[model samples]
Target: MWSFVGKKNQQRWLWHAIDHASGKVLAYVLADHTDAALKSLMQLLTPFGIEQFYTDGWGGYARLLDEDQHEVGKHYTQKIERKHLTLRTRIKRLARKTICFSKSEWMHDIVIGLFINRYEFGLPI
Candidate 1:
């Protein structure tokens, strides 16, 4: 989970799932970094038939995913971490230490969602 501040410095987590091999974005959810948000991301990833899950040391991953399939470390999660960098570069709201940010949660999500869908997933906007 990655987060950015929205209007009034309200933090919003970007819960995203990506393919390890191809580095393609599978799904994403904009919400708090909580069990419920992780569950929502898991539901989206379920359709992909993912066999392994690489994550950080987040407790939600441990609870939701099978022990055998879950691998915890920044080393294993490099692809997604790189993807976050790409997002930060492309989207001002995602950039750390930037004054350029979304004024509303709705617009913040819409901009990020459209960028991911069009650029990452190759869907027409």
Candidate 2:
């Protein structure tokens, strides 16, 4: 998922793979930018032999997915991309520049993970 720090700030970050078929968010980490984000995402994805993957024209995605069965530069990734937008809208805290409200990084992870699992995965809240 590509996310920005705020509407006023352009600093973007990513959360790793979301299983579109199952609506399971496989992994997530706070990253610095697209490069670092792709590196971590690749690491997380190494175990899975994906037959095909899709993404936007993020340069880092090109580099990492070069070895895999990736389909880039297409509009097919729009679904997962839109999911990020839904998450940002639903989770007010994730919306731009709201506050430094995470109690701690660990707590932030737990809360966000739970939220994603409940809301994104259609699990019972």
* Best candidate according to lDDT: 1
Residues 64-125 of candidate 2 have per-residue lDDT tens digits of 66646776665665656677777778766566456654444455456567777787567775
Tell me the number of clashing residue pairs for each predicted model. 0, 0
Clashing pairs in 2: none
Predicted candidate 1 versus true structure: per-residue lDDT over 84-125, tens digit per residue: 888888887776556766777787788888988898889999
Question: Which candidate leads in TM-score?
Answer: 1
How well does each candidate superpose onto the true structure, as a TM-score?
Answer: 0.88, 0.65
TM-score of 2: 0.65
RMSD of 2: 3.9
- Per-prediction CA RMSD (Å): 2.0, 3.9
Q: How many backbone clashes does candidate 1 have?
A: 0
Candidate 2 stretches greater than 4 Å from native: 2-12, 99-111, 117-125
